[model samples]
Target: MTYTIGFLGTGNIAADMARALNGSGHKILVSQRNAKTAAALAAAMPEVTIAPNETVVANADILFLCLLARTAAQVLPGLPFRADQTVISVMVDMPLARLRSLCAPATDIVLTIPLPPIAQGGCPLPVFPDCPALHRLFGDRNLILPQPSETALNAHLAASAICATLLDQMMTTADWLAAFTGDDDAAQAYVAAMIRGYLSDRPRPGALPAALRGLSTEGGLNATLRAAMAPAKDSLRNGLDGFRPRLGLPLGPEP
Candidate 1:
């Protein structure tokens, strides 16, 4: 099936999802906000259409609530939603319960976190619990990481923030290496491949340190780099520690 998907916002990420699903045989309907973006997406994808904001909500079988965090409250109540529709929220830090209360009570509200790379089919798509509809939409294209409970969702939120932090640091390092080494493309490619390999080979449970144990070898490049990155990693750990209380999530056992 061809499901009617209504997108409530016209942000970059929202447009990216629309592009990812382009020509997938599904009908894509976008709200009349950010007229320029909506028009562009509609033009690019034959299946995409620009409808009045209210009309999109009422007509869509599945709603993608991509509104900005600041304005979702003001915009949500005004949309005409159907009782049996499935509403999937992409806004961060918004609880599922709050989303349920804001939308039509009969609709199933699910919270999801979608990274920018979804346009390239590499998104770290995180969803709460299980929903067959969501499974059909994103299960094939992205790494669908589902959390078991609200506590798990909070951890996922922290993970999302950590992803941004890590990416920023990685990009900055790549830029610095490019500037000093006079090989921008090579620097970025090297860093990207390094991180990908590291993540792919990461060990589980107590095996993590063992996996990284080779780094402590005497006078090695890895040892030198680990020393340089130690303070930054410690600071990140402290920041994550502070976030746990704010998220109301239990702390993992101390090592």
Candidate 2:
């Protein structure tokens, strides 16, 4: 079924979503808060239109809340949401209960984290409360990971921050290669292609550990690098543990 998808905030993520959903046979209504982004999206996609926040809420079947937490708090309370609309929030650090309260009497609230890769499809979407509307919209192109709880969804969101760190590490490796080869573009392309090829294997459950074991062959360069990165791995774990309090999870070991 085609949907009237409304983006409550026209930010980068919202723009990306608009791009992803452009030809999905659904009409997209993007709020005019970020006029430039909304206008650009409308110009690029005939199915998309820029509209007032209230008009978006009044017309949409599924409303995506892509606003900042502060902006959502300030804006949502003023909009008129229908009881039939499904609300999906991508705002970081916003709790489900708070969203439910702000979006009431529209009880179909789902929390999700959609990364920038979504525009090109194949992005992993971590969604809370297994929303059928989201599945209908994104199941064909993206991986919809139905999270068990809000905390689990939040954990997935927190883990996504590692994408930046991974890219930084890749760029550092590319810089080192460039220093040795004196070819910056070639180094960067080689490093990016190598990483992409490695990740494209789509490891099955328990396959990651096997891949690591295979790579860490004793006395090999991969083994040497893996050994050297042990401290970095520990630091990554500690960083993830640091997010427990913010994610409303227990301070100690995960239950």
lDDT per residue as tens, model 1, 27-71: 999987889999999889999999988888888888888998668
TM-score of each: 0.87, 0.96
Clash statistics: count for each candidate: 0, 0
Query: Among these predicted structures, which one has the highest TM-score?
Result: 2
Give candidate 1 misplaced runs (Cα > 4 Å).
199-211, 214-216, 245-255
Kindly list the per-residue Cα lDDT of model 2 for residues 63-131, writing each as its tens digit.
Answer: 999999998898889689989999999999789999888998899999999999989988999899999
What's the CA RMSD of model 2 in angstroms? 1.3
Q: Each candidate: what lDDT?
A: 0.80, 0.90
What's model 2's lDDT at 237? 84
